[model samples]
Target: MRAAVFVFKRFCGSSFRLQNRGVCDVAVVGGGIVGLSSARELIIRHPNLSFTLLEKENELALHQSGHNSGVIHSGIYYTPGSLKAQLCVKGASLAYKYCDDKGIPYKRCGKLIVAVEREEISRLKALYERGLQNNVKDLSLIDARGIREREPYCRGIMALDSPYTGIVDWCLVALTYAKDFQNAGGSIVTGFEASDISMATESPAGEPEGLKYPVIIRNTKGEEVRCRYVLTCGGLYSDRLSAISGCSTEPRIVPFRGDYLVLKPEKSYLIKGNIYPVPDPRFPFLGVHFTPRIDGSVWLGPNAVLAFKREGYNLFDFNAKDFTDALLFRGLQKLVLKNLLYGISEMYRGVFLGAQVKILQKYIPELGRSDIMRGPSGVRAQALDSGGNLVDDFVFDGGVGELGGRVLHVRNAPSPAATSSLAIAEMIADELEVRFNL
Candidate 1:
């Protein structure tokens, strides 16, 4: 074991030496931060348990987790006592500590939620109160002058100074988790795409039912491998995966692409910290704002525009089927009609970069069209309900007694999910333990 470890270390650094030491007691599908974090927690809690993490991509955090704004949210925006609030607060603290200990770059840069108009003041105050209830300490209400004091060029009627907010490179964090999971005798297989999941229960005698799924996944090379106890964190395709598991719940995933603009280095000083708008009570997303990344580059944006495809990254990208489904879906129709004005405004702002610049200049008067560079975008996999309302919380549905009843399917996990990754993992691991009696 020592010689093998040494040889492995000589080839691949001591941190990520093991790539395929073989399968284990657990198989985590998806190599995003959430899956990697879950794998790390599972191995740490039960060292005796062997684990395997399968990712369809060549590297982890390649999608939403990596594309995010890198903000270490302070649990300020979420409703108090909700899962988002609870998990975000806990996750933020744990993330900072973990990053610090692991030598990963991070900053408690704090944040400012600004109300630019008189009408936004009430919502700003409500968010402030909610932050307090969520135990976000040191939330100070800052008037326009106060905002200018912190961010000299900023504009706003009032703002909330949340010192608990911060930023970190999520890609780095996910890589660290991969390294740790591998070092702890866990297997991480990249380019392994899970095709289907079969479900069944574990008998009292510890025998897996014949209906039990041995997850069939094809590697990048098209080689198929089977595994027991498949736990999926498939992000955008979660609902589809659940359908494959024979679950009746048909929650449609609507993709909302958030476009960003990174302020040129010269204009980066416009924000002393994170600057946000008082979110509309009707919507879950906190409108576009300034986020000072840990790397010192400031970014503005994330206009929620409907994407024609699930994984559409480019402006011109589209899928005929995806667009047709979205247009036909009752929830999508209702969402558009209910927020027609806001939706129209968002769409107009998205196409005309000059319009977006005006919105930015509301806070940073110095920003010009040339100062904004095209930054990366992230797609939110928002789940729509039968009632045509957007599902706000994380949604999970396991086929109870359907596939002999052993599969737990997570249909929706968005937003603070990246923040609540560790806690979410604990939840997944606990449920799996009971299901498999391991």
Candidate 2:
């Protein structure tokens, strides 16, 4: 395509309709942080290869990536040698570096997980030990006096200081990545939903076994395209996409709505950086925390409650089909039965504004029920196994000479996911190299 044509079409937001648009070597099915980061890495690693990223929305980062807490995790909560730990540490540095080079705003404001009473002390100590194992730098155990020094208003008896933890504008980061990808000869097809994917026929004669078939992709607008490989990084719809690709994983995505409260402008400075509660060992999400956003606003939140729709962001956003599907899913039934007590409590808090205010008061005693307001909410895409258990770690399943050998499916890319984007992309690239001779 000519430079003039590219410029004119991009300006018109009709770049995908260009008649001479190039074919793709790789087709990424999602435009969130993971897919875009993967697209950027693939292009950077092999500039000669053509690539395209498809998003259902008119703009990128419209979902999880856009609504995240803006915290750059410190790698202190994950187990050692795990993908979450490795990627978080490495990707945090890369995220900061990219933000610096692009002149995007970010801060190394630090985080704390506080223990309010005697019963929580054991969990607090365990978190400190885990931080050490994860190689988190400058982590310390702080008593009440020390905690007061870090956060004067916090009401904790003991705390775990994670200095490496900080905040960044993730949506800004995603926007920056989109710009970088396009500048480096990559195509992003927004408002183009990936409706279907199918394997191509094997070539005749001496064609290499690895590059036998391309993954055929059809967009929502009824346009069909093909690529030598497919990388599924659909955030909320990841498992569903895998099911469509002929994988029998059967992980039904259960949306958990995490709501927040942006403190009134005057009360914003009540907590300096990020102040967290030591997490429940059984739960995957970090308990409610105070996070300072890049725009200098302090917010509290992220209570996990079942959502009626996969992308439902509001209390009134509901789909009968989605609700019935989740209700009938045997796995969800098992999961609920196993954690009935906690599930009930979370639902109670979800309805009562006072219950949520109590969770906040543990960390910030000055916060009153009247000081809270409905902050923007985000939906978490949680996956459940056939037996009704939440998949807690990164899970990938593929092998040589398989049904979808080279096409690696991303089943669950959860929290710390944005923080781990670049590292995960590198790992995916490495896997392709080994499995398909990329």
Candidate 3:
């Protein structure tokens, strides 16, 4: 085997065909923030081992990582002992530090989970207690006057103020991880859509490396990376990747599109920082909320609705296979039936601008339908179990038999995945050390 012949062009928008590429000790299968972070960490921790990052697209972070609300979540809403809760609190701190060390700019713009109704105060209290249990920094239970002090036009009987909840260009953060991975001598290969992962029984001809690159990682275009170990952080396609590797896809990836309405620039200043509603415990998603991006523009209302396509952004965007998969899935079917009214309400809000503004006005009475217009949208890859439960935690798998020891699949990383990425990478590094005997 030869050393990898790939060269870099600043780690994004660059594609290299794997022509006679050398076998790497590890091949990371995803180019999003988490995959990049893990690859960077793995390579940095084991510099003697060669590594490569394989991205399906021609660029990185072009999906979930790029199209998010860019909020560095403060770990307020997750179950107290869950991976999301643990990693998000620690990841937020690490994200801030990483930005500091990388000179990447971010804003600790803060967030307020406002309880508009008297009955909602109990849920708000629970949320506050959960934040405390999770060690979210500087969480405070503020009254109506305190909410007014923080967001002048906002209205709430009570609110949980997360002073350290911040915003950043996650795409920038992901790119920085790509840079770090490359800087640490890890090769980045774009346009390498991973189609399969299988362990080898014997070495390939002429290599004579004694099964050194035994793990066969293939792409749809017939290209492959023969590596010693594989790590998949596939976001939307995680289940497919896992299934092909002989793992159960019981918790399948279901795409849900969230559509946002941006506040008119003149009205952007009505509220400061993020303003969220008291979430209903029945729902997996945090209901529609106001999010101020790092770019100074304020956005309101990201109503979650069923997406017809995994990569769909528009109301009518459709992929037959994606639609069929969602429609046939028993978990999604049961989920929709259970939350029928809630799903209808989300869909209604997504369709009618006035309906969405009405909800937004709950917090800021000053807002109206005319004060906002459609904004950018993103597809959330939610994982669902066969029994119709939303899998609301981190799920990792490595299949069975020979490949079990050679690959790891991040099957599901719920909301706050972006906030938890760096910390999640540290956990992945620990897993690799013990699982792969690194």
Candidate 4:
């Protein structure tokens, strides 16, 4: 065990190469797509500035960015004037351009929002209008025949077609971003878990107080790095990391596990593109849907259930602290009470394969329990407010108190986050440039 521990420490130490006197212009916490993109954007905009990116895991995109459904959303479901709608619409184009420039493979396969029942058609129409309002191009409301033309096996009274929707391997995209950041002279240090952030008072002689490096970040290994500014894109632990930097904790992260079912090889042909249901507006989570991955397999489901741990991917995975945090939160309690039926139904589908197949059969009448095998799962970092309302849009909170004007935190960025990563990075960079005169 001692030998193993020694080897582990040596390996991690080699990756970081931390210097006792090392400093940077910026330190980005979190190595997900957003962090990588942010780092890339910073280096591109300010060619001479230095940056350090910290990640707890040895590799990047092992969490939400890796586990997502890989759907390039077309700005359909978000509120018209919200950040999600704006960023997602812009991000889709940016993502495609990035993919083309990087030679990353992607497809503009289009998507169908199917309304199987009469009640859903009205809601579907409302969504179509919302999409139009959000400036989603090539969006059209279609009848049953139109749905047939788009997705032959999909059963629906009506549907909305988004031709701009597409798919790409997001993990690959994130890796490419990491490579670009490194190529631009930004340092990426994995296995460095940022434990606390404090203000650094020391400044170089004759430096203005406002220009001094004010943020000190300490990792679990007791290593310290000082920076003039900090941007945290911590996905699952955003709240904790923000609070460590003297930011408000009114909205806390709650982990929700979304499990998918991969169709059998023969059954993969059932979905040509993406098929989705009209989502409940009260919550941000889109309902169970059919997604065709770039790898030529169809994925169904992603039923949302409270996860016992932030990174829990298996059914029985548990963590006492994570479980207790969700259970004891007043916001979770209120959210559960308000959406009791929906929550119970989602949990049911999570547990029973038949229940999930039933939901999928609403769109693909041919799907049976035997047609699918258990596939991968991802945990969403859902943010809930103290008042029990689930945050429904992209949320960014700049630090306050001691860390004021020096730190920025992304409190909630789920679903379309991977798609909006580059555009989101641009927004963060713009904010930092204006605030710090970068």
Candidate 4 clash figure, as a count:
0
Q: Per-prediction count of colliding residue pairs? A: 0, 0, 0, 0
Name model 1 segments beyond 4 Å from true: 1-23, 199-222, 400-405
Per-residue alpha-carbon lDDT of candidate 3 for residues 343-424, written as tens digits (9 for 90 to 100): 9999988888899888888999998888898999999999999788998889999879988899899999777889889999
Top model number, lDDT: 3
Tens-place lDDT per residue, model 1, 1-438, is: 011121122111223433543334567878788888888888888898777887776567778887889888888877787887888888888888888899888888888888888998888888889888999868999888998888888888899999888888887887788788888888877656777665323322333554333444344354544455667778887777677777754688888888898889987767778888788878646778998888799888978889988888777789998778778988888888888888888888888889889988887888899988888888888899766788877776774444323456667776877777877777777877787776
TM-scores of the models, in the order given? 0.89, 0.91, 0.95, 0.92
Q: At residue 240, what lDDT does model 2 achieve?
A: 69
Return the candidate ranking by TM-score, descending: 3, 4, 2, 1
Off by over 4 Å in 4: 1-21, 201-212, 282-284
| Top-TM-score structure, candidate number | 3
Tens digits of per-residue lDDT, candidate 4, 1-438, equal: 010111112211122232223468899999899998999999999989889888888777779988899989999888899998999999999999999999999999999998888888788989999999999989999999999899888888999999999999998898889878878888877777899998866664555666467688888877777788898989999999988977777689999999999999997778898999888676547889998999898888889999999999998999999999999999999989988888998988887899999888999999889999999999999999977887877777887776777888878886699889899999989988987788
The TM-score measured for candidate 2 stands at 0.91
RMSD of 1: 4.6
> In model 3, what is the error at residue 82, expressed in angstroms?
1.8
- Clash pairs (backbone) in predicted model 3: none
Model 1 scores a C-alpha lDDT of 0.76
- Model 2 poorest 10 in a row by lDDT: 1-10
Cα lDDT tens digits, model 2, 119-218, are 9999889888887888788999999999989898988889998888888888777776777788888887766677777765654245466544456677
